[model samples]
Target: MTHQTADATDHPTVAALVARSNRLGGDPRNTNYAGGNTSAKGTAPDPVTGQDIELLWVKGSGGDLGTLQPKGLAVLRLDRMRALADVYPGLDREDEMVAAFDYCLHGKGGAAPSIDTAMHGLVDAPHVDHLHPDSGIALATAADGEALTREIFGDQVVWVPWRRPGFQLGLDIAAIKAKNPQAIGCILGGHGITAWGDTSEECEERSLDIIRRAEDFIVSRAASRDAHPFGPQRPGYEPLPDDERRARAAALAPVIRGLASFDAPQVGHFTDSSVVLDFLARERLLPLAELGTSCPDHFLRTKVKPLVVDVPTSATVEETVTALRAAHAAYRADYAAYYERGAAAARARGEEPPAMRGADPTIVLVPGVGMFSYGRNKQTARVAGEFYVNAINVMRGAETISTYAPIAEDEKFRIEYWALEEAKLQRMPAPKPLAMRVALVTGAASGIGKAIATRLAAEGACVVVADLDLAKATAAAAELGSADVAIGIAMDVSSEAAVQAGLREAVLAFGGVDLVVNNAGLSLSRSLFETTEADWDLQHNVMAKGSFLVSREAARVLVDQGLGGDIVYISSKNSVFAGPNNIAYSATKADQAHQVRLLAAELGEHGIRVNGVNPDGVVRGSGIFASGWGANRAAVYGVPEEKLGEFYAQRTLLKREVLPENVAAAVFALCSSDFSHTTGLHVPVDAGVAAAFLR
Candidate 1:
């Protein structure tokens, strides 16, 4: 490829690079999410020298190419970056070179330069791209990849043997390019592919061309083969019907999540996509999954391998769950040994290995159900699943054309425990207090429930806003965050069937339940003589009975997860204080208050904590009060409806009005680490109402 002169305007060159990157990344067939980098070189005026200087702009660390912005690009002086080659230490010290990139930065350098910055800067091309497209990786990981590369594109594409990515790999690619000027790109052994061109358009085209050709080669060869790449589908391993699979997944998600969170709590993602189902049903699933994923991007998120449960689709949920526990224990033991072997290998080479990561597997596959991937948050978990699917595609293609041969186990261990990778993990911001936890708040569409949901989402928990009105709940969920962070579902707590269905939706959305807020209620202000049996029943059903049902249903999931969880009841101060013309409301609240204590006592053995928040007279922005409760209470107390809030506030010791936000804050506190050890306790958000104080 001939070198093109630097563009006169640097902006257009970078703009074109970003455009090309987005095109490649937006398509899943081009590359897995955030698994590729693109670069462009141009001429820019130096701030200090007032002269034209060559600069390299590349996608920075921790950014997805599909959503790359100008600010996400790291700009470096190409001359300064190339100069590092003179003092570059041997491959053993390649990590030190990453730190040296900072010194070569131009201006603010935008985002942090990634390790692949060297590959972009030293490639000696105006435009460069390195991608992990499934088709390209299929050929790269094939046993005869070098021969296939020669056969696929003849001499147009070259083959680079397996080498760990760093400064040395960059130098090696540059040398390959210099030696074969006529070569368009190279298939990186046990990795992906690299392509370059004199211009951005040409580079992108070459990349797509390589990917298309590799895909065609595999497809054509597969057509000639007699057997399926993954072998025949096992007799009892076929996927269940869509509805059955989802229901089974809902039941097992908590158990798998609990086991995966042995080291730390994790959010989970469940997928029954075609790729996952096809792979799971195949007879070769166990052996191929055990061999682990080939791509570095794949294993880093999915872990070295997945845990494949052997239970058949016809097995009962209870029996399947029992098998899962035994399998999980064995998986942990094997991972421990794998870590020791890798550490020993490092020691033998006179290198101190980084501490092993969590021993629990991030991915779980069941033949009848689907794939479940876990991570510290919902987005991470979902992305991990997507990467595993990409790995599946790679395996399917590789096995079709030739034997799927990944890098050595020691190499996988080396990359998995790299010091640089550990540094990236350490640099991540501290997680929010509610991070990795999932909360389902009943009646979260408005008032106290909505406030609580908002606060929980802000603190980093995935929230499910459950209300009788699906539209309102959906609107509230939208306000909170994206689907990954929050979702909405309809629930009529008065019905046990509805309660169970709502909980199932919550689990499907975010793995399992960690926090349950029983806040759904209706208030009827009436004296004992005026209260009808119907009114009493309605109040009790929505408040007392409803709380019990929600707790009972959620408790099953919590216990199954085996991770300690919190259950909060939104009881009222009226539960302790006797208020006139409020017989039914007060009695229901009192029932809720006692139920909290009883549940706390019963569930403590399972590490589930039940607590309550007693809020007095939340008139403003309150659904219960706005639905005629405020006017009814006002008439009973000989006060105007507008003055009801003031009347309630004046009676309190502090004389301050209690708002919905105050109640939400109390709920947050009860569910926070500060109250981890304090169960069966109710904190009053009643502005110091002495009458409601706990005896």
Candidate 2:
């Protein structure tokens, strides 16, 4: 990686471009300089670009992007790039410039495109970027980067071996893009790649995505092979002195936020608990999992790693967390101290953290100590920090074989920062294949929603009941409790935050999230004219918008877990076939059905299936259904309670008003592996209302 050279007149611009390249801001941050180069080819197109969709301008290569000048940007005719790709099907390092040139860039109008132009010309994105980041390098070193990439990103991204730069890489980009018109880019293993998007920001976002994925993969591998810390399966803990507990919490709180995640309460509680304390204090409770981060993208979900600390019972949670609170800050302070101390200690010593200093730490395994990471996002924190408690145990058994040594810091950083490597993270949005195996149900209270949730739970899923009625969700959970069954969450589906919070807790509790039943809904029997707007909104908010919020978050978790998921919308027959003069009740349910269809397409690649069920009038009694059918029908049709069943049932071919339990059965079917491929379609519970009517 030598520095770029520049012509005298282009010195200033070249310097600026060189600086930009070296800053290492976006994708390929830590591992770039050779993957891809930017060269502005010609002037802007005649049309003005729209907002949020800027024409991310790239200067063509005069010298190189590493030291490109405004003039260095060839502004060449893009036509050449396009033509070149079409002509050169077998481009490679040996291809002559003119011979490969025709095969690389083509004429858009009559203009000659840049040599690396095919990539810039053909991509259908607003922004196109090419980089070789550091993390990619680390990932590639293991020789399993490709498999790992496919596992995490699904089918959105493409991974290719390193090809020679210039025309060869350019042709490869065009070929891949032609086949996957919707593709972002591909990883150029040893070389680099060219990526495109609808906009520059989008391009940057995609770049970030690639690096993160690569980082996550490599880190995971490093952790798996190396033995650093050995911790227990269950965190060991015991009561700690109050002073120590509070002290630990206070000390670790801020660092935890930066390195673990937002859930301070859970972290503090877990750390302070007797179980965790005992585990941390145990001399042998080394790193359980030397968690290498998935990638910088995972940074958003998991900080770096957990501080797997082992402390004596005397060391309260507060004391330990609190004491460690100053650790990060102290570390930062120490970096400066080390830098200054080095000035006095020795000039040759690198003044930086061990990680940055080119010293690959197999994590500092303090015998009785717990694990930790550099940032928040605790999920990753635990992964990053746990020095593979497993590795520790294995090593203990293998002490006779040989001691372990962490990879070198420079190598680690090289892998961490490589660009050609990070492109894997920027892959497309699709569901991982893993999520299909698991399912979760909530509001297993009773009636329609409960029936659906419970059904899934019974089908070998680790069912967890979540509802506003904690007792009810709990009772339902208890009744179904088994090897795979779990507990209940007292959540009010009506509240946006509550639903999200509950679902998140479930995701963390369970390793992943797959099926979500947006089944908790209520129907008020007030007639059309009598319903207030507020009442209508309340109903819609829960039945419609609530589902929206829940499905959105659920999809994210599902995608992250690299597993497919399912969402079942429980509707009423009233949604499609008009029921009386009722407006609010029917309208909201209809909205629910529509929403399901739309989300199905959006989440399809993620393998998240969305479907709807329109159950008929469910018979109710004095229990959870006290107000189930309160008067709307009796008021409109002026029908007596005695003849309601006869009136409603007579309309159906089966002559039966669908029961709450029956609706639940439909929901259960829609959400399980039974309907793994079904989505975007709505099924009616009304026996033959629509089916019987050939008219």
Candidate 3:
């Protein structure tokens, strides 16, 4: 995607962009496996002349900045950016959230803005360039990282303690910009640095200088260390003679390919790191809480901590590696579960999914294991190891100091997935109809609403449960509670006026809304064919009209917020599969499903995701299969209702009936990331009963 022709000269401005990125560096090594991207402000079209504003040449996605080109840059209207930022707070969740990816936001059309785009936005410089510089990251992740920032940039740089990178961080910057006009650059605590100047060269100069200084600090600090910072492995730290440290590196070199490359008589391979380890081996070292190493970006080389994976050298190399692989899988799965739970909690609260990865899978802390800085290449891996080695040392050293608290779960998400993360890897999928955004569920009191709400919640959506039956919604909410779990509100999901009031209150609680599960239908009507119109009207008003009214109000909030949301109708399977009873129920179910498709097409353009879940002949549940379903089965199978489930349990090919909980889990699956790409699709949750594959 090379965009600009080389003028056969070094663009000083581009050089400065590159230089600025290197300033906070330990190593200006090309850290991102994908390289770097620099964006100069593009020219806007003269409205009357109809001329296009020229965009700065930035490296396109997958194009690293180590060797950059103009095609990598996305040409965009610098002026329209604020509006774009305000409109799309959760844009960071996109697989690729670059201004260049879509023509609509940040002028990125198919090309994304840098992963650090938002941080760059904070500077307000005409040009912004981001790179994975070793020195800057190392300095940022250090124990006394803030003091380092003060030592180098002084008052000129706005120092932000390590926080998750995301919309809120962007919002914070926007707020900070208002207060301090002179501040141009900022250091993200536990992250990296941002430098900006009126001219790209000036900014570049400042950034490069900063990196060199930070790198020097790293070198000197390593010299001051008495022992290996990570402490001694296998416990009971023994004082290692200096010569023994070099001997150890020598002995370990063959196993780890890269350490030997940097080995030298004057500066032995990993000597400084060795010193830090010896220190760590000491019994009284840095407390575990003080340790902070999450990324190669946060600290040039060590993305994760130096994991002292307790594997035996005695084991075959392949066997050891296999164990490591298994451990890694378990760690990832556990982390993913954590992510799903937290994300689901937020979804229940009726908000957009957190911008940062819920799991923070990026940084894994194995208590006694070596570290991992997942880079595109080995150089990146080795460089990251350098800082991780030191930081663990500092953390151990800091045991004398007060405990260091890492950023909170809410805060971590702010940075890792911040809207401005430098564009690097794959572009986020074009905004799916639903996306894995968050949605709130109301009328999640029990039965259908609970099932639908639970389903959506499980889909990794952050959901909220609101119902007149607060006890029930609360219980439901209890099931979903995690780090950032969903909230339970007491009220009706209906009542045009109540809906308005509840939504207003709920929206104020969370930032906004995305999806509304209109599951608050009530039924006192016994039978339509056997009963009167008054009975029917009551059912229609509460069940049918209530959903319509709620949908209208919910849509207003969704559309007004400008974040397209989803609306799932918990229509029953009776809509299509009729039974002798439930005449009124069947009519409402049919209407609910029919309404879903219409709503989907209408809101499609608004970026809203809407769908329906229809479950038929669902048996209520106390346990896996205890009571409510038995009577239904007993009657259907012509046996005593108690023996009914026994008859039907083997009826399906899978030998199961759709438990109410099964329906609930199904609903969640459909709305979560598993089914994010699917909308306007009616998902049936009747367990094979609908298919009749079983004899």
Whole-model lDDT per candidate: 0.92, 0.49, 0.50
Each prediction's TM-score versus the true structure: 0.97, 0.42, 0.42
Put down candidate 3 lDDT per residue, 1-695, tens digits, no spaces: 22332211254544554444333222334244453345555344344455544334344544545444433444344445444565563643533334433543332342455444544444456754444445556555556667766776677666676655444455565566557677656666655555555676765665666656666666666677665444345442343454543333222322222111112100011223444444444443434523444443443233222323344334434554455446555545655654565566556655445343322122222222222332222233334445455455335423322233344544443333333442332334443323233456656766656666666655544567888767776788778764134667776544667666666544433334556776665443244466568757766776677777777777766665454556777776666775554577678777877788888888888766778776644445332123233444355457785555445556545567666676566555565556757778777766555442212
lDDT of 2 by residue, 388-501 (tens): 332222223222122222233232333343232233223323432222233445445776666665566555455558777888877777887642345677777777778766
Off by over 4 Å in 2: 1-443, 482-484, 620-625, 628-630, 691-695
Question: Top TM-score: which candidate number?
Answer: 1
- Number of clashes in every candidate structure? 0, 156, 113
The candidate maximizing lDDT is: 1
lDDT for predicted candidate 1 compared with the true structure: 0.92
Better of 1 and 2 by TM-score: 1
lDDT of 1 by residue, 337-431 (tens): 99999999989988898887788989999997999999999999999999999999999999999989998899999889988889999999999
Answer with 1 or 3, whichever has the higher TM-score: 1
Sorted by lDDT (best first), the order is 1, 3, 2
